[model samples]
Target chain A: MAEEMKVIYERPRSWANKVTHYCPGCTHGVAHRLVAELVDEMGLLDKTIAVWPVGCAVLGYEYFTFDSVEAAHGRAPAMATGIKVTNPDNFVFTYQGDGDLASIGMAEIVHAAARGWPITVIFINNGNYGMTGGQMAPTTLLGQKTTTSPLGRTPQTNGFPIRVAEMLAQLDGPAYIARVSLDSPVNIRKAKSAMRKAFNAQVRGIGFSMVECLSTCPTNWKLTPVESMERIRKEVMPYFPLGEFKVAQGVL
Target chain B: MSDKVLMKGAEALAEGAIQAGCRFYFGYPITPQNETPEYMSRRLPEVGGRFVQAESEVASINMVYGAACAGVRVMTSSSSPGISLMQEGISYISGSNVPCVVMNAMRGGPGLGNIAPAQADYFQAVKGGGNGDYKRIVLAPSSIQEGVDLFVDAFELADKYRMVVMVIVDGLIGQMMEPVEFKTKVDVSTLKTPEWATVGRHGRDHANVITSLTLDAAGLEKWNLKLQAKYAQVERSESRIEEYQMDDADYAIIAYGTMARIAKTTVRVARAKGIKLGLLRPITVWPFPAKQLQAYAPKLKGALTVELAYRQLFEDVQLALCGKIPLGWFGRGGGVVPGPQEILAAFEEQFGKGR
Candidate 1:
């Protein structure tokens, strides 16, 4: 008996053939690959500009094969707004982390969404501040222990984790908003679907679209890669409910 | 012949930027400079340009940063506190070598001192306000007409050097009305967009990456040295100063911006009293006219550096003269404008041999 097999899956043409700087047990690599694959599928490599954030992705331009610019801490949304407004024909998006977008950049992202800016935002919500030594971030769970919250986050001291997708969906301007997680194969496939939908909304000239990915930082969370994925499924998924919150009336 | 139009300093500067081919403006409303964004909002749309009233000053400067990297002439105007908020973004822009124009309609400071006219931010303007070894091509305009002219020149200088160019004026100039002549307009077609701009991948073979993070120490050093070389060239080629009635004079007053206007009056009163006095007004403060001042150092008995802040500009004058000529300083602060009589009295107290 003879068997024949064909190779179908490979790296996207939009991604540079190089190693990432993210630590082991980190899901940023997966997020990056998904973006590259989607951008390649949509053929947006030639007319896309990515705004990098000040967190671990400060050197993100090195991994992407498209035009990119680095923004100061918490300023990516503002920079993205300007780029989209000035170059409306090009595809523009901002890659930001919870600390960069939710903590210091709250105003920038909120206003950009409210203005109905035609751009995409890929918000990575990894409960802890992974870049700065496992510090407490705006998305940290209620009882999660971080460097800044050593005694474990208490309601009296640290407030509840921010539900970004829900908050942004409340704004009347966004065309599509969804929260997804990368905890398991089933969730990951769903995450890709949500991302693809968000990118499609942007391509169709729909107003601001955002995809919030619940990612895992095992090293920072002090867990194995397997355990971290389980944590995202059990702990982070409950508070940050997944699914589409706002799909513009006609944008589906 | 050109027509003279009566306009506020803010509006004149806005019109001048348009003539200079500036196509994008991002600003937040602040006193003494609110009219600038207002003027741009109404005029930019007519010319196919863009304007955005940003969420905050921090957001506005970052917007300018993005537009600048996209290969467009952009600007943002603010006051003292707002400019302070923009320092971090300005540092990023300077480090990336993105060409843009920023105008600071300075009001009283040291912490929201007042809304009145003051030169308290002279040090923050000429020196590097943000972290890094960088300098802004600071232009100080004493009159509304001069502000318009300087605004036009700022765009060219920023493009040619690929750095931030600043026009620092007091609240008085921003709010006051004066007749200004619009005689010149730089050809927008002649301006070159560098190969590094992120205007898409149509013409270039590779994607452009605009960033300031040089993680390697040696790499960062090389960039800093390149910036220093450009600054050296600017110093040699762009130093500008106006010397008034310096012929056969013994006492000279070194001033700039609104202080220069007051010093002009001081020169008149001192000369009327039979004292040989003159004025040296610096138009470009960063590439300071130190060479011109040095040329007159031997001829003058002494010099008085006048400013709204206490001894801020005096530090620069001293550095330029380096003790070869004795320098005296006098001024008022916290939005207080020194009177001509008060300045004349200070000049006599310091340089007067009989008094």
Candidate 2:
């Protein structure tokens, strides 16, 4: 008789065996694992409820073994509001992409933040709309080329990308709001830590906690994974600086 | 002991919610229904309940979504325009199968039509008000008393069916103040709730999965079957109707909400002139009290249906008859509530034509 050996980098217990449908080099796969690892670590494996908004991450329900609900396009915050308010005992969080949160869903997220709902939000701002194909996002960089902006995004006809973390940080309700990135190994570690801190904030009922990560999509960006990560480091971080934008005392 | 008070229909619903153990209300002010939230703001705190004025109807319904998940009876109110904005959230609640009340004191609209009473939302309300194949247990209340009692019933139905319950009324009911008796007072402290509530993992089982999506087709179909079964039970156990003056009647009138009360008055007036007319008023808009109407339909010469809107409720009455009896419909829209006098004239015309 033999017993299987335990492993660290093995698949997380809270995430299913479904191979991530994310394009190669898409950091959503990495981001998801980080969240699942934290849920497993904090013993919230049984009680965590994650909301997946309609975007590149709409299929997030398939990846997480923890219970997940898919909200309508731009309605994740509202859906999360329902779940969190009704079951405040469970750790509730929303995983939203750039367009889902910063653009069409701005009303929902802003209002949720203002109310100080005790929930966690992991926002992956990948600069362009991925699922609907390459399109300008609220976080899309100036002069970025996309299907919607063939020539390039111009200031007169198209608006500039939004800095969501810094904007939300100035609000009073969020206990923590940080800008993290996945462009490098050091930043990846920081991103996971920031996510853990946000979930921990929800655990303490401190208020809303959000970490907006600057991620990249190689398939949509028309680049290889290596090139995409490099572009994110050099191009995205210049506008959306990574740091702790706001924090409530004693939340961490 | 029932305590009596005179309150606006909108105000009555708010007070009834408080009495029904509701401690949180989130809503945006809209015409013909602003009193509900305004009252909650003043009264919820008195009862140690929470009342939040959301940024918009979209936010308000979501606020209720949050509060309802916390295991409390919660609600939001808006007129046509605001309610339209809330349709997406209402769909979310239905899909997730959350228990909460949404009061649409309907005003005229395909858009923001007017602040006056209208029954134009009947199709929207009884037909799930949003996407997905589901239905809200729609209760169309006719007066201030029904406004209060219907909300009480709505909460119970919401919890029972585990779906959204709509206290479907209009501006006329929302604004009119009438005497109402509170038959019961809710003490939330005495109630037991599902452990799935998101009140923070305290003394409970693992967090309940309160979502509507099951990506697997078979799983979603199974959930749908369960929901459909629950709705069937409501049709069997909770269907209601009020009949008036049907003895030896030759022609019957089918109506609901304010239109039914108005029809009752019309029947009484027509009775004085010696017309053998009856009234069939539906209480549960979805189950529709169809069998009762069908029973009357075969025996009567004809039936006339009335509503504030053109033809929504009339369709239901017709289906009830299943072509066993002749049916006629007359309604007005755009801020006008049908009066008994006009209805009486239509009844005479309908009766004569059928005879």
Q: Name the candidate that leads on TM-score.
A: 1
Query: What are the candidates' individual DockQ scores?
Result: 0.78, 0.37
Per-model C-alpha RMSD = 1.6, 3.4
Cand. 1 TM to true fold? 0.97
**Predicted candidate 1 versus true structure: per-residue lDDT over B1-355, tens digit per residue:** 2899999988988988888788899999999889999999999998889999999999999999999999888999999999999999999999999999999988987897788888888888888899999888999999988888887889989988998999999788888899988878766677677788887776467989999899999999999999999999999999899998899788788999888998898788878888888999899999888999999988988888999988888888998987787788998888999888899888878877412
TM-score of chain B of 1: 0.97
Proportion of native contacts present in model 1? 0.71
Model 2 chain B scores worst on lDDT over the 10 consecutive residues at: B200-209
Provide the interface RMSD of candidate 1 in angstroms, 1 decimal place. Answer: 1.0
Candidate 1 Cα errors over 4 Å, as ranges: A1-5, B187-190, B353-355
For model 2, what is the alpha-carbon lDDT of residue A73? 73
lDDT of each: 0.89, 0.82
Error of 1 at B244 (Å): 1.1
